[model samples]
Target: MKYNNQRPVVIGVTGGSGSGKTTVSRKIFNELSQNSILILQQDSYYNDQANMTMEQRANVNYDHPLAFDTDLLIEQLSQLLDYKAIEKPVYDYNLLTRGTETIHQEPREVIILEGILILDDARLRDLMDIKVFVDTDDDIRIIRRIQRDTQERGRSLDGIIEQYLNTVKPMYHQFVEPTKRYADIIVPEGGNNQVAIDLLTTKIRSILMQRGNDKIINNKDSTI
Candidate 1:
């Protein structure tokens, strides 16, 4: 199906590590037609560290805003908004650097940008039509982080705990948590808040419909 010429609606979802921002993003993506929506993860924009030693890359604080290649992300997102395709980067968690492969992403009607520090950048915030913050407790976040790192990222429980204490927790308080004030909607308990998810999906569908109607009106005017 051909989407209208209208630019994609960008929704920003942010929260601390293991705060269920990814879960929220996936829930919204599932609610929409799969073909018309895409989820762009900020994790994919981590600065390439191929030249660095494994130890150096490992020591780099992944939770900090500086760890991301934000400029590249902004450029690629702009391309998508212009209804263009982009080669999205793939990050290797175990390698602690970007992978060699690229994923070709087509422009979609809806784009969900999910990350911990998405709201920390003003330029990113400007691109978003809606901003959402997932508010999960620190204890809950740490538990989730431990599970994800161990089960998916091949990280040891001891290493995860040490990193969380040394970097993630401090960075969240200094950078990520403060950005919650910028959010248009604050969702307590992240994806578990079904009412918020429903409301968000309804709003997104409404915008999509309005854009469709506008496209029809524009076509009629051109004929006249």
Candidate 2:
């Protein structure tokens, strides 16, 4: 399939775990042309732990920036920006390691990179045209985390609580929260912030339109 010749616009959405950044990303995505957009989750790039035992994997501090295979993520994202397809990695929450399957992703006009620690890395930040941080209270975040982990991730309530207290909470303060300063936009209520979502959607559409105009001009100049 043919891809847009113009470079893709990359939008980075980052916030603490359970801060509703995914929801915000989805809202922005749905508002735009779905055919021209792709959402890339940072969680999908978790470091491979195949060499480690289950016990070792389980003990890993996943909330930390060091837990991500950021080099691979940057490489794949750069490929996408260059209008190349990629075999994106799949992360298994249950196994605490990379999954056996790979997802085939095609290049798109717009890419939304969403994750808790996406903004923590300078290389990732440099790739983004727009940087957004979804700000939510810690109390609400923990509550959401408890519900999501228990229901979707098959995590025990005790384990979820322990992980939150031991790593997730502290790591958020140390790494995730600090990245908010890098954001061009800060949505206070995540997906619930309709105004912010609408504004972002409008901005992305404008960028896409500009790219389309540039492509048209380039094609005309080629004919001349």
Candidate 3:
């Protein structure tokens, strides 16, 4: 129920794995001052599989909606939008575990919720002031995923391929793709699309300025 009347502008950016959603989100973040932006990555909300063995965890369909601790993510986002601080959770893909240390995230003027499945949930979607979906070719996405998983997430090439075929592809079809219809904007080629980024940036800046203008007018009236 809290809003910029008491909260920040909430932006949701989502897409399929390796779809450059993060790149798009990063572009938006870079446009703003560090103090004005708060980024919440959806991967950080993955449900912990501590009780499961490594083998069991590896079998989990991470692309599935059930794979995320959506409730917790929703709660954390709600608190942040309510002008409250939260301890953001951290998930480690290398270990397939949640880290013990949490980041103390303070409220900011702009909050970006970045993930593959962000638009899939109505509750989360309802909170967003601006919603974006990055559209890219599946082949391109898979290639990027393979490279990222192998180099950064410490995944084997074979394992990545297997997972992509077994779960990631199917889940994207079932869940992620369908949610694209809900987006206010569809960004083709993700962050590399300078035109889309420019238009978006202009709109965001306009909103920021309007809010500032309102505050200034309110102050002047108060003195009168």
Candidate 4:
């Protein structure tokens, strides 16, 4: 049996809740599709809430790193890096449960993995070639999260505030903020940091272009 270390490039972006990791990931995905790209959101890997009753789920602390199934996530990511298709779990925040369904993703030249705790997990962090941390003020993040949850996730203002005050803020200080040291790039102000985003996009383009050129010479379908 043979193992392959040379796999698709992986980028990991992590940050505190509502720090704009998702926004950055989406932007990168949109910009990098010329050579095909797969985006995996760590939020989708949240542990299944099926075992818990509605009340239990309601009381669950989602900000904890343990709330996610990191082993499964790592396995799926490794498969993608090996040029294999993977069915990634889809977590529903509104229902506070992991659906039976998953999104089937094909291997691509680039894979962007974004989440709050991406850098916190040592095993997963080792997989990323480029690691980014979005740094935003806690007040700003909380405000954005409240708005996002209320509008997008169907959460009430009171509920959002309660969760942030009780679970999100403390967990961020404990687990997320300290992981900033691991980032190759630190993006401040989340999605509003255009300069940082552009720089990152350019870096990605250069890598893809270089690799694509080589692949083309080697008879690989180079679409970049």
Please write out the lDDT profile of model 4 over residues 173-224, one tens digit for every residue. Answer: 9999999999999999888888888899888767755565334222222221
Tell me the number of clashing residue pairs for each predicted model: 0, 0, 0, 0
For model 1, which pairs clash? none
Give the worst 10-residue stretch by lDDT in candidate 2: 215-224
TM-score of decoy 4: 0.90
Model 3 agreement with the true structure over 89-180: per-residue lDDT tens digits: 88977678788878888777778899999998999999998999999999999999999988887878998899899989999999999999
The Cα local distance difference test for each model comes to: 0.87, 0.86, 0.82, 0.81
Candidates 3 and 4, the one with greater TM-score: 3
All candidates: TM-score: 0.93, 0.93, 0.90, 0.90
Clashing pairs in 3: none
Q: Is candidate 2 or candidate 3 better by TM-score?
A: 2
The alpha-carbon lDDT assigned to residue 18 of candidate 2 equals 89
lDDT, candidate 1, 1-224, per-residue tens: 45566888889999999999999998887776433678899999999999999989988999999999999999999998998989999999879999999998877778899999999999999999999999999999999999998898888899999999999999999999999999999999988999999999889877877777333322211100
List where candidate 4 sits over 4 angstroms from the true fold.
1-6, 212-224
Measured with C-alpha atoms, the lDDT of residue 25 in candidate 4 is 78
Model 3 score (lDDT): 0.82
Model 3 residue runs over 4 Å out of place are 1-4, 213-224
Candidate number that wins on lDDT, 2 or 3: 2
Order by lDDT, highest first:
1, 2, 3, 4
| Backbone clashes (count) for model 3 | 0
TM-score of 3: 0.90
Sequence-dependent TM-score of model 2: 0.93
Which stretch of 10 consecutive residues in model 3 shows the poorest summed lDDT? 215-224
